[model samples]
Target: MSPQTCTEGFAYDRRARQCIDVDECRTLPDACRGDMRCVNQNGGYLCIPRTYSDTSCILGYTLAEDGTCNDIDECETNSHHCNPTQVCINTAGGYTCSCTEGYWLIGGQCQDIDECRYGYCQQLCANVPGSYSCSCNPGFILNPDSRTCLDVNECEDEPCSHRCFNTYGSFMCNCDEGFELAADGTSCIDLDECSFSEFLCQHRCVNAPGSFSCICPPGYYVYEDGRSCEDINECDTGNNTCTTAQVCFNFQGGYTCLDPLQCHSPYIEVSDNQCMCSAENPACRDKPFTILYRHMDLSSGRSVPADIFQMQATTRYPGAFYIFQIKSGNEGREFYMRQTSNVSATLILARPIKGPREVVLDLEMVTVNNVINFRGSSIIRLTIFVSEHPF
Candidate 1:
C-alpha cells in the first residue's frame, strides 16, 4: 500500500491510503434542500439540488427540521424588545407587533383609561390595565358589585345632636337645646329665655331659653325651700322699744304700738292713741229686762191669763212657736219665737227693767198645724239683760 501525498505529487492510491469520498446527502437528507443529492468523488462531497414543485422559504425564513419553513420567536428571548403596549407574535421567519385590546398601543404599556364612554359602570367606571374599577357619583358610594354606587347612610353615625338627616351624598345634624343649626354646622340659635319658664330656675324663676333666674319679694326672705317666703320677726329679741303705755304688735313686714281703747277688755297698757281696757273697766256692765206675757191658739180666743207671765217660757212651750212684743216704756223690749225646731230665741234689753210697769208684751199664734198637740194657746215669759262689748 502507498502512503498519501499532497497535491502536485502524482501517482498515489487516493481511494485506498488517501482521503475517501463520503455521501453526506444520503445521511442528512432532511437537512439539505429537497432536490439536492450528495456526490462522493474525492475527499469532499458536492451537492446537486433538484428543481422543486413547490415554492421555497423566503429570505427572512429558514427551513425547519420537518422540511417546512418557520419564523423565529423574538418575543421569547426578551419581552423588552417590543413596546410595552404591543404584543409580538412569531410567524414564518418574522414577528408581528400589535397593540392589546382596549389600548391605543402608543409607546407600549397599558394605562388607566376612562370607561365612561362605553357606560361600563352604573354611574362611573374607570378602566385600568387588565381590569376596571367602579365608583358612584359624588353623592353616592360604590356598591358591593363595585360597578355601581349606592346611597350613603348618614343616620347610622348619630351625627345630629337632635336629629340626623340623610341627603344625596351627605347628612345633616340637628340641634335640640333651645337652638337651631344654621346653613353651616358652626352656628346655633338660642331659644327665648322668658318662655318655658317652668323648666328653668325654680321658685319664681324666669327662663331665657338658654338660661334663667330666681327672685324673692321684699320684707320676706326666700326660704331654704326656695319656693316659699318667710316673714321677718321684727318683735323678736328685746326690740320692745315701744313706750311703757303702748304694746307692740308684730305685722308681716314690721311692728306697731296700740293704745288702751283699741286693745279692748283684758288689756293692761295702751298708748300711741290706741285704747286698751280690762274686765274691771267701768264701761263693762250687765243690763237686765222683763218679758211681757203672750199667748197663742187659745180656744175661746180670750186674752192669755196673767199667770203666764209668772213662769219662764222655756218649759211651757217646749216645741211651740210664740211671738212677744214688749212695751217701748222698757227700752223698746220685744221678742219673737223661733219657728225652726230645736232652736231658741232670747229677749235682751240694753238696760235693766226695775218694775212691772217697765214693760208689756202681746203674744199670739200665727199658725196651727196637725203636727202640734197643744190644748190651749202657747204662752211664754222671760227675763233678760244686756251684756257690754261682745253684745
Candidate 2:
C-alpha cells in the first residue's frame, strides 16, 4: 500500500481512489477575508472582494502592515449606502442597513408598525414613528407603571356642594338630610318641605335652608312635637282686653268681649248674638232682617285667597235661592263672598293685609223665592283682628 500527496485545495479520497477538490469556503475559517467571497478552483481557492473601490485595498477593507486585510468601519467614514433616515451598522468589509425604533425593514425599506393595533392601553393608544404611548379613560389616570389604569378621585377636588363620595373610576355627589341635588347634580338646594304635602304642619309650614319648620297660627302655639299645634286660652293667660261693661268669653283659640247690654234702637235684640230690624220703623225697609256678630284673629302675612269664614242660612225651604255679596268694609277690594250653595256662603280674603290692623266686613246673604214672591236678607258683622306677628 502506498500514500499519495495532493496539492493545496485538493484532498486524497481512498474510497474513490483519486484526489478530490477541497471546499475551502467550508473547511477554512478565514478562507474568505473581510466579507470576501471564496471561490474554489480545480487545485486552489480564491478570496473575491465584495466591494472594490479602493486603490490599494478592497473597499470597506484596509491593507494591514502584515499584508492581511482588516475590515474598515464605513459607518465612521460615512461611506455606507444607508440613507439619512436609516442607521448604518458597521460589519466586516461592509455595513448593514437598519431603521430607527418602531420601524421594521422589509425588502430594503423601513415600514411603520402600528402598535395601537395590539391594544396596549386600557382606553386609548397612540403609535409614534419609533415608539408608542398608552392613555386612560375619563375619570381615570395612568399609573406609574405606564400600563396600568387607576381611578381618579374627583372628590379630592371638592366638586360637590354638599358631600362627595368617591367610587371606582367615578365619583358621586350627595345632599344632606333636608336638601336635594340640583339639576347640575353637584349643587344642593333646599327641599321645600312645605311644597311636598299639606299635612306636614298642623297650622303652617315654613322652609329654610337645608331644613323646615312648622309654625302655629294666631291663638295657638307649636306643641311639644315640632309639627303639631296646641290652642292657647287667652282668658286664662289674662291676654284679653275686657272693659267693665263687657265680660270675657273663652273660645277654642281666642277670647271675646261681649257687653250684656241690649241692642241699640231700630235694631231690636233677638238673641245673645243677633239683632232684628223692627218692621214698624221706616228704616226697616232697608235694614236686614237679622244681624249677627262674629270675631276672628289672624296672623300677619297670612296667605291670600283664604276662605276664612262660612255662613249658613237658617232657612232650608225647598223653593229658596240665595245671593251673597260683600256689602261693606271692603274698601280695598280685600274681601269677596262666594255662594257655595242655596243656603251657604263663604268669605274669601283676596288681598293680604299687613298687621296689626283691624278689618270689619259686612257680608250679606239674601234668600228669594219667585213662587212665594218673598225675599229676605241677613247680614254678618265679621270682625277680624290681624296680629303683628306670624306664629
Candidate 3:
C-alpha cells in the first residue's frame, strides 16, 4: 500500500498487498471503560462489562467511561423526591432528604415545626414557611436581635401631665403628691382638698395648685391652733371709727359704739353755790340744785366694796341742823345712801349691775335753823357698764 493512500481506520502496511482491518482494540486500550473488556470493530472499539463492580453503580449514581461511579447531584438537577420545604443533599452514591429551618421531616414528609413551643422568642413567635419571626406585644417594640422584646418608652413624648412610669409590656401615667390622675390615664388633674374634707379650714377654704390654704373671714383671724378662727379686737387695732366721746366696745365678731349720756340745761347746775342764791332772785324761789355724775365699769356678777359717790354740803351759817332725803330716780333700789354727819353723805351700790343701765339719784337737803332757812337739792347720775369679758 502507498504510504499516503491508507483507508480511514487502517494505516498503510508495505507488506500487505491490499487493505486490511487494523487491531485498534489492542492498540487503544483507553478507548472504552478502564475496567471493562474492549471489543475490536472495523473502524472503532466497544467496551464490555468485565465484573459487576465495573458495570454497576449505587442509587442516584451512574457508571462513567473510566469505570468509576460518580455521585449525581439530585438537588441541583431537580431529580430528588424531597418536598418543597425540604432540602436534598448528595452522597457518594445516593441522596438524602432533610427538613428546612422551620420544618421537620416526619414519615418521609416535611411538616411545619412549632418553634413557639420551644421558647424561641422572648415575647411572641410566629412561624413562616421555612423560618420563624419574633414579635412584641402592645406598648413594646421588637429588638434588633429579632429574639428579644424591649419596653417602649411612652414617657419620651411626655404623654402624662406630671410623671410617667414604664412597666413590662405596658406603661403608666402618674401624678405628683397633690394631684390625681385624670380619667384618660395620660393626664393629671388637681385634687380638690376642700371638697373632700371640711375640717381642712375652720372659716374659709382656698384651693391652690398642689395644696390648700385656710382663711378667716372679716373681723376674725386664725387662732393658735392653725385651724380654728378667733374674733379680732377692732378697738385695740385702731380700726374703729368711734368719736372721742364715744366708747368702742368689742364683741365676738365686731365692735359697737356707745354714746355718752347728756343732761338738759334745766337739770344741770351752773353755779357752784346754788344754795346761796338770793331770795330776790327767781332761782331762789325754787330749790337750789347741784348735779354730779360718775361712770363705773364692773364685771358682771362682781361687787365693789368702795363707795360709788360721796357728797359734802355746807350752809353759810354754822350750827345748822340739816336732813337728807332721797327723792326720785333709782329710788335707792340699786344704791344705799349713808349720812356720816349732818353735812356729809355717801352712796354705795347694792350689787353689781347685771346689764348696762343708768341710775339717777335726787337728794333734798333741808336746813332746820339757818339765816335764810332755805332748802337745797342735788342730782346724781351713775352709769354702770356690764361687760361679759375683761376689758
Candidate 4:
C-alpha cells in the first residue's frame, strides 16, 4: 500500500494506508447553496437545508430556510431608506434613491427646488418647498392663467367731467376748443379769449362763456367779416339829424354837416347862417313874392284847390334865364309844390292838418343874362296858418 492513488471524491491517508471520504463543504463554505448545510458522506458531500429567522436577513437582503442571504427588493417591499418625496429603485443588493416632483436630492436629503430659475412666471415667481406661484407688479394684476400679468383700465369709471383719456396705468382729462381744464383736473373752465393779444378784434373785444365778441364804437358797425369794424355812412341811410339844407359828410367815426347857403346880388348873409333879402336893394323888395291859402275836409278826405304862388320876371336882354327853388322849411314832408315855369309855381298840402299848424316857405329866385353880364337873386318868405275848423 505504499504510494497508492485514490479515485475521484476520495483521498488517501498515509497513516491508515486506505481511501477516505473528502468533506469538500467543510473546506469550501461556498461549495453549496447559501441557505443549505454541507454534510460529509462516503467519498462525497451532501448539501442539507438549514433554518433562519426574519432577523437573520441583512439590511438589504432576505433570509431563506436554507440559511442563505438573497437580494431583497426594498422598492417593492416598501422598506427603502428614502424620504416620502423621493423615488425608490430596486438594485442588485439595495435600492437607489431619487427626488420626486418639485424636489431635488442634495446631500442625501430632499430639498425644495427653485422653479423661478426656469422662468416659470412672466413677472414674479415665488418658490415653496415643492411648488411655485406667480404674481404681478404695482400697476398690474395677475392673469387667470397664473403665469402672466395684465394692465388695468383706469378710464372705465369716467374720472373726468368733460373728457377722459386712458393711459397705461392712469387717466387724463381734456377740454374742448375755447375751454381749459380746471385745477381739479376733472372740471372744465372757460378760456378768456379777450385776454390774449393775438385775438384779432378791430375795435373792442368782449369775453363770454367760452368765446369772445368784437364790438364797434359809435358811428361804426361790424363788417361782414365779423372781425373788423367799418365806418357807417349816415347820409346813405338817411339817419343823420342834420337839416335838408345841410349836407352830411361821412368821416371815420362821425359825420360832418355842410351848409350850402350862398348870398347873391339881391341877398345878404344873415347871422343865422342863411341868405336873407337885402333891404337896401330895390330888387329885393319886389322879390316876386305871392301867397295864397287852402282848406280841406277831414271827414271826406278831400282837399280844396291848392294855393297858387306866382312870380314873373322880364329882362330886356335876350338869353336871360330864371331859376326858382325853396330855401328851407321843407322837412315836414306835409307840403308839395310844382313850378309851372321858372318863376311861377303852386304849393299844396299833402293831407288834411289834424290841428292848427303854421307853415313857412322860404323861396329864392336867381337870374343869369350873358348879354347884360349881370346875375341877380331874390328871397321871398311866406307864412300860412291852417286851422282845424274852417278858416
Candidate 5:
C-alpha cells in the first residue's frame, strides 16, 4: 500500500488504505520545553506545549492539553506545595506528602503528641508520644539490676537491743536489761524503775528509778520490791504468818489484813466535797402567803373637790378579809380597818358631793362612774393587808 494523502492542497492516492500523521514542524527539533508536552489526536495531530498542559503546568495554572493531566511534579513549583510538616513527593498523575517522626499525620497535616494529658500510668510514668515509663512499687526502691525495682530489708541488721519489730521494708530491736524503748524504735535506754514504791517500812533497797522495794525490820517477813510488808500467810509460807484478828488480801509484792468490822465507808471525803441534799433530805419548806398591789389613773379632764368621799368595793380570800375606808385629804388618802366574821368588809362615806369625788379604799375592788369624776386631777389609792382569820 502507498502512503495515504489528504485532499485539498495535498494529493491523495486512490489505492492506499492507511493515512499517516504528518509532522507539522519537521524542521524544528526542540519543539516542546520542560514546561510543555505534546499530544497526538485524530484528523490532524495537535501540538500543546507542557506550559499549556494542565498536568505539566504549575499548581495555579489551568489545563491546555484537552483538560487531561498526564503527570504532575508538586516539588518543582512550590517545594513543599502542601503542608510545611509534610515531605513533598512527586507522582505520575498527582502530588502528595506525609508527616515525619514526633508528629502524627492528620487529615492533611501533622499534630503534636499530648503526652501528659492521657494519664499514662499508675504511680508515676512519663509518656513521650512514641515512648513511656513506669514507677517502683511501695516498700521497694528502683533497682539498677535489670533496670527494675527491688525490696529493702529493714531487719537485716540487729537494730534494737530488747524488742525487735519487723515492718514492711524495715525492722527494729528493743532492749530488756531494765531498759525501755526510746521515741525511736531502733534504740533502747534504762527505765525509771524506783518511783512506784508503796511501802513506808522499807529500811534500805537500791532504788532504781523505774522500780523500788521496802526493807522490813527484824522478826518481820520482807515483801518484794515496791510493795508494803504484811504478815505472810504462814499456812502457805511454811511459817505461822497470820494473826487471829486479821483477814488477808494478797497483792503483787505485798498483802493486807484487817478486822472485818473495822472496814467502813470512809467519811473523810464528806469534809472535802460539797454537801448535796435532795427531796429525800429537804433543806427548807415554802411559806403560804399572797401578794397585794393596786393600779389607778386620774381622768385627764376630771378633778376632785377640795373635800369629797365615796364608797369602794373589796376582795376576800377564803380564810381572810380585806376592807377599804375613805380618808380626808385633797391629794393624800388613808385606809381604815375593822375585823368581821364575813371574809369581806364594806364602808360607806359620811359626806357626799355631786362634783368630782376623791376616795381611797383598803381592799382590792373598785366601783367607778362618769358622775364620780374628780374636780381636781387626782388618782384613787387602795392599801390593804390580808388577815388569815376573820372575826
Candidate 6:
C-alpha cells in the first residue's frame, strides 16, 4: 500500500504503488535561474553553469553552424540556461554562472573529522565546529587524495588570446609583433607603432591591421630604410614621356618635358620657345610650326570627369578665334577637350582608368586669324602615367 503523503522530493504516481523522484527541474523551472543549467538528480536537481557542464564546449570553441570554431548565440537559439524570470546575458565564449560552486559528495554523511581541524591546504585554511575542508589557491586544484594541490596549466587550453605561457600558478599572455595584448590579458588589439614617431614615414604613414606602410609623393619613392623619401630622377630612369624631339628636366617633386630647340618638318627654330614655317614651301604653309610634349601622373581608379591637363595660348592675338580638338591616340575616347575660354582649353578624363598603364594623346589647337588670312596650329603630345596603386 502507498503512504498518504510522499517525502519532500518524492511524488506518488497515479497507482501509488511506490514513490518516484520528483523532476523539480521541469516542474519548478525557476529552481535554477540565470545561466544555471538544471541537472535532474535522484531526489533533487543540481544547477551548474553551461560553461562548466560535463559537455563544456570551450575546448573546441562553440558548436558553430558550419562545423567550425565560431561563437554560437545561445540566447538567440533559446539554448541559454537563464530561466524565464531572468534576463539572458551572453558572453564571448559562454555565459556567467548564477549557481554556487558544487561540493564534492561522498557515499554518505559523516561527523566532523579530527584531522581537518589540523588543516591540510597549500593556500588557505578554515576550521569550524562540525565541518572543515582543505582548499587550494585560485590557480590550483585539489588532488584525489584531498590533501595535495596541483598547479593549473592554463596555456594548454589555447592562445590566452593569441599566445600563452604558463607559469607556476598562473599564465601570461603575449601577442605577436604587430599586435598588443589587451588589459584583460585574454585579448589582443592592433598596435599603432607609426604614432610613436613622425620620422617613421617621410611624407605619410598608413596604419593597417597588423602592419604599416610609408608612402612618398608622386616624384619620389620610399627609401631602403622604409622611412625616408628620395627624389626620383625621371630623366635618368626613363620615367618621362619625352619623345626624341623633347627633353626631360627633373625637379624636386615633378618633371617637365621641354622642346629641344630644334625644328621638324619644314619648320625652322626662330626663338627660345618658338618656331617658324618656311614661307617658300607651299606644303609647309598650313603645317604647325610648334610642337610640345607634356606628361602627367595619376593614381589608379581616378574619378572620371576630372580635369587632367590644361593648355593655354601663351601668345594671344586680336581678331583670332581658337579651336581645340583631340587629333589622334585617343582611340578609347577616354578624354575630351573642354574649351574653358577662347584662349584656354582643359583636358577632361571621360572615364576612370585602372593602372599601371600609359595613355598617349595628340592634341591640336588651331588659331583662326580673322583680321589676316592666316591660320596657325600647334600639336601637343601628352603622356599620362597611371600608377598601379592609389596613394
Query: Per-residue alpha-carbon lDDT of model 3 for 1-391, expressed as tens digits?
Result: 2333545654543453223345667677577766776655443445667775456764546778888777777778888676765677554434555545556555546677677878989988887776788999898888899999888887787888888887776779988987999899987788888898887877678888987778886667888876677768888998999999887877555566767645443443344312233445565456445555545455444466557666667554565676665666665376667788878777766756554344446655555555566455554444455544322
TM-score leaderboard ranking: 3, 2, 6, 4, 1, 5
Which segments of model 6 are wrong by more than 4 Å? 1-172, 176-220, 223-231, 234-262, 271-275, 388-391
Residue 57 displacement in candidate 3 (angstroms): 6.9
- Global lDDT of each candidate: 0.44, 0.77, 0.64, 0.64, 0.40, 0.71
Q: What 10-residue stretch in candidate 2 is worst by lDDT?
A: 1-10
Model 1 poorest ten-residue lDDT run: 382-391
Model 3 backbone overlap count: 0
Judging by lDDT against the true structure, name the best candidate.
Answer: 2
* lDDT digits (tens) for residues 1-391 of candidate 1: 1234333212233333222223344455554555664443222344555433134554334578888866545567552255665666543333445444444322234343446666778886777764577778776888777777788887886666567778878877777776767666735566566565553433366545555456544434667765455555555644656776766555443445544333334433344332333335555322111112222111111222212222223544445544333323343433333333332333333333232121344332222223575332322322222111110
Total clashing pairs for each candidate: 25, 0, 0, 3, 35, 0
**Residue pairs in steric clash, candidate 4?**
35-66, 35-67, 35-68
Q: After superposition, how far is residue 139 of candidate 1 from its true place, in Å?
A: 7.7
Against the true structure, candidate 1 has what lDDT? 0.44
List TM-scores for all candidates, in order.
0.31, 0.47, 0.50, 0.41, 0.27, 0.45
Candidate that beats the other on TM-score, 1 or 6, i.e. the better one: 6
Angstrom error at residue 219, model 3: 1.4
TM for candidate 1 is: 0.31
- Residue 358, model 3, lDDT: 40
Of 2 and 4, the candidate ranking higher by TM-score: 2
Candidate 4 per-residue lDDT over residues 254-307, each given as its tens digit: 555656646565656564444566556677665533222121122112264445
Of the candidates numbered 1 and 5, which has the greater TM-score value? 1
Q: Model 2, range 266-310, lDDT digits (tens) per residue? A: 898888778899767898877788789887877667898899999
**lDDT measured at residue 96 in model 2 versus the true structure, 0 to 100:** 56
Q: Tens-digit lDDT track for model 5 on 78-185?
A: 744567766654543334453344444445455654444565443455666545565655656665542355666655565665567676555657677667778886
